[model samples]
Target: MKELAGQTALVTGGTAGIGLESARLLARHGATVIITGRSQQRGEAAVAELGAGVRFVAADLADLESVQALVRHCGDQVDIVVNNAASFPGALTVEQDVTSFESTFDTNVRGAYFLVAALAPAMLRRGHGSIVNVTSMVAFKGVPGASSYSASKAALESLTRSWAAEFGPHGVRVNSVAPGPTATAGVTAEWGDVNDELGRALPLGRTAQAAEIAEAVLFLASPRSSFVTGSTLHADGGGVAA
Candidate 1:
């Protein structure tokens, strides 16, 4: 789909896991891709792995300063933006205080929410663009032990809705791709051995590959989904339904 041949994209948390896979697909489909990650070496390695037509930016989603830096850099050239980067501080582990809750929200919500606020106007000026904010099935179903994570992602979905409503008139579409139990490095780190059990519980009886979910994002970002503003494409194998 060279439909995006002349376009530019910025994917956050794109050094590994789902972000890397998505970047590959977008670049292959003819979009010049720029991915972000905290690790300089990993970010470079990922760009290298994608071989060509892909670039890298350094940004830590947990740091507002880094987020600003990322936004400024990407503002230089971009038509599409994928807020695919996120962090989970474990489920239900409350700090029982404003500071702790804020710590968690800072990355999952504040960082991403404001990043787009800072960058989307540039898209608006371009007169056309698509923004895909990645959420999770956990945001819909109250996944056990993921209370905080779920709530944060829910906030992201909320941002998607409000932003789309506010910006759609400018020809900027905002949508989301909510993936479930994907095989990514972060999932491996967090879900561990229990991931296999979770997969068995899915209606499809298996977890989806990163590429499968990435493809969904590609569709939403492409003109094919021009009418898809403010909507969420759930690629969870019916996990939320079941």
Candidate 2:
């Protein structure tokens, strides 16, 4: 039997990249996966690629109303919630504008916080669930030209600990996966062929594939990780270690 048979998962920002990969993995494990994105077109395409047992919900995490609507639309309890939606606009502290900072936090931290708040009660009632927040290595090592993004992810790391403590007694687990430089379309578009640079800088000597990061998420979300909670798994090719 499939490990995740009869389970249901919600993956935010699942239109592409790591989110899409994670959602696909969960579906493969026999979970009914609900993927959310801001773009209906991209969400539809992702749904098509993800095949059966997968659906798309359009949502903009930056807006609280939209997040609430998404939660309401889900209705049923979610066995796994991947808070993977995030905004990554890099800017040095000196160059940072209010809009950029607010938008990043609104999407990355605030949205995730409320999402867990909205779904965790249902999980507690159901007596078993997992919440995986997609953080970043910058939360630990920091990064130039990414002050707001780093800060937002750092905030998420903090929440992982807090939520784990608050929800563990109820049989719900909250954890985080922090990826280093990943070879996603968005990353390549922004950094431009950074494989060699990351290969030299990271201990593993190569940036991660999106599926590699998704594997970490699946581990944390699975019964195999029943004893794990409140931990941030670094899928960062040893970026933080070095």
Candidate 3:
């Protein structure tokens, strides 16, 4: 039998990149996967591509109403929650505007915070669930032009520990996966060759693939890491070490 045959998973920002890959992995393991994205077209495309047992929900993490609507749609049967939706607006600290900074936190931190707050009660009631927050290595190390993004991820990493403590007693596990420079579609589009250049500095000498990071997410979401909680699994290509 598949390890996640009887489970259900909800992946935010799951229409592409690491989020989509994570959804694919969870579904492959037999979980009924629900993916969310701001674009209905992309969400439907993801569902179609993923095939049976995977569905898509339209949501905007930056909006509170959308988050609530998403929670309502989920209806409390999610065994795994992958908080992978985030906004990365790169700008130096002094050059960053208030709007972008707020938007970053609203989407990356507040959105995930409220989503977990709303979903965790159901997990607590059932006494078994897992939450894997997709953070970044930038949360630990300083990165130029990524002040807001890095701070938001750092907040998420902190929340993982807090949530683990709050929910672990009830049999729910909360952890985080921090990926370094990854070759996701969005990253490829935005950073172009810079990602490769950055990867060369890492000990592994290459940027990670989305699937590689997704595998880490899968481990944390699955029973394989049943004893692990409040931990940040670094899926980075040794960027944290270097």
Candidate number with greatest TM-score: 3
Model 2 residue 183 CA deviation in Å: 0.7
**Looking at model 3, which ten-residue stretch has the lowest summed lDDT?**
187-196
What tens digits encode model 3's per-residue C-alpha lDDT throughout 119-193?
Answer: 999999999999999999999988788789999999999999999999999999999999999988888776678
Model 2, which residues run further than 4 Å from truth? 193-196
Worst 10 residues of 1 by lDDT: 89-98
Best by lDDT: 3
- Each prediction's TM-score versus the true structure: 0.94, 0.97, 0.98
Candidate 1 positional error at 182, Å: 0.9
Residue 79, candidate 2: Cα error in Å is 1.2
Error of 2 at 22 (Å): 0.4
What's model 1's lDDT at 12?
A: 89
lDDT of 1 by residue, 14-90 (tens): 99878898899899989999999889999889988998899898888778898888887776577888988887655
What TM-score does candidate 3 get on C-alpha atoms? 0.98
- The best-first sequence of candidates by TM-score reads 3, 2, 1
lDDT (Cα atoms) of all candidates against the true structure: 0.86, 0.91, 0.94
Compared with the true structure, what per-residue lDDT tens digits does model 2 show for residues 106-158?
Answer: 99999999988898888999889999999998898866777889899999999
